[model samples]
Target: MKRLLLIGVLGLALGGCATPKYNYQAVSQNISKPAIGSVNEAYVGDKMLTQGVFMEREAYYVPEAKKKFLLNIPKGYYLKTGEDQKGSYYQPVNAIPDGAAFVGVQSVLITRDNSFCFVDVYFNKVCNFKNIGEKRKISVANDNSFQQTLIYSGKVGSKINVGYREFSSNLARPAFNNDVEYDLNESKTIGYKGALLEVIDANNQSITYKVLRNFNKVD
Candidate 1:
């Protein structure tokens, strides 16, 4: 019995260690509330630069290295690394480590509206707008986490204008500007990727929908 208990305890410890740590900062106070078109443009820009600036998932940061490392762990926070290629933060320290692996976003200067937009390596959006982006982090405990609802704009005759969006991965473009028109008389169901929805009712200002199936990735 004692041996079995010890094995269970060890298994729990191993499982805890396997869980990934999230050291993200609180939402940014200055959120970038870009227009819908601007948001679409940002996604396209990210897709274009996917192979260039946001290419490397991880890089080594040496103090003597010619390229300057972009520190993105919020303003007051600090990122610390160990000699064993592991990163952790404790009390504040000044001395820079010799070789540190940078697993966060890459520093890419993207131009947006004559201003430089620092694209985050994670979501490919402006790094400073981390807080605004967190809205997309749906809670797994919520039933709506599996849903991909449509956004209603306006209706004209039999055409209904709606928008669809979903959280994007680092390797792909963010989903945006999926505004499409559906004919109410012809069909009440609409789909994107594998997410199916039934438009029960709609008007110029609002829409009522029934989620037929949860969202799935596009093949």
Candidate 2:
């Protein structure tokens, strides 16, 4: 009798450890297409990674490696839709964007190695492209000053506030001319509201960010 009871307990424990699979049909069918003047948010924990808005053009808010990459969807391209264990997948329809192909779902991993904070991007649910791009340096200061700096103001519920100064730099691979530089002048406390968990950024020296609990609320 005791042996049977032990077996039953073991079975229950294993069942509890099993990974839960979401109903893809129900989830995908309900995904709303981006509306004009509306913002769609994606997150890593409490940090906001991408905040896409549909305006005159589809704008993507990609904050990676302490740098903000606000890219517009290329002309004649639409967002291809899919989802995975990681999160919702949005890739350019039919063709590659900016010469980079989206093989599959995308995810981000944060790692620390001695003096650098690595915001690693994973594609197709795998960490394959570790050295494919140039490593941009970001500086994290211990004190707040007049100079431009990357700052996470705070978070209220699902809204994450971030502040930064205006700056412009050349893309690692400039599409038009190698001599041309992209201007980035978003210097204000912006709030990323709804459907996000974390906001991550790094300095040239260290990582400075906040991570809320792991709550994947896909809406």
Per-candidate TM-scores read 0.30, 0.17
The lDDT for every candidate, in the order shown, is 0.33, 0.25
lDDT of 2 by residue, 1-219 (tens): 553353354331111111112232211111112222333343322222322111121212232322213212222222223333433333323122243332221322211211111111321122222222222222211112112122333444334344433222211112321111111133212222232222243222322333332112324
Candidate 1 local lDDT, 58-153, one digit each (tens): 111222222223332222212222111122221122122322333432332212222212322332323222121111111111111222334556
Name the regions of candidate 1 deviating beyond 4 angstroms.
1-149, 169-177, 217-219
Q: How many backbone clashes does candidate 2 have?
A: 14
Estimate the overall C-alpha local distance difference test score of candidate 1. Answer: 0.33
- How much is 176 displaced in model 1, in angstroms? 6.1
Whose TM-score is greatest here? Answer: 1
For model 2 the local lDDT of residue 37 reads 31
TM-score (C-alpha, index-matched) for candidate 2: 0.17
Worst 10 residues of 2 by lDDT: 111-120
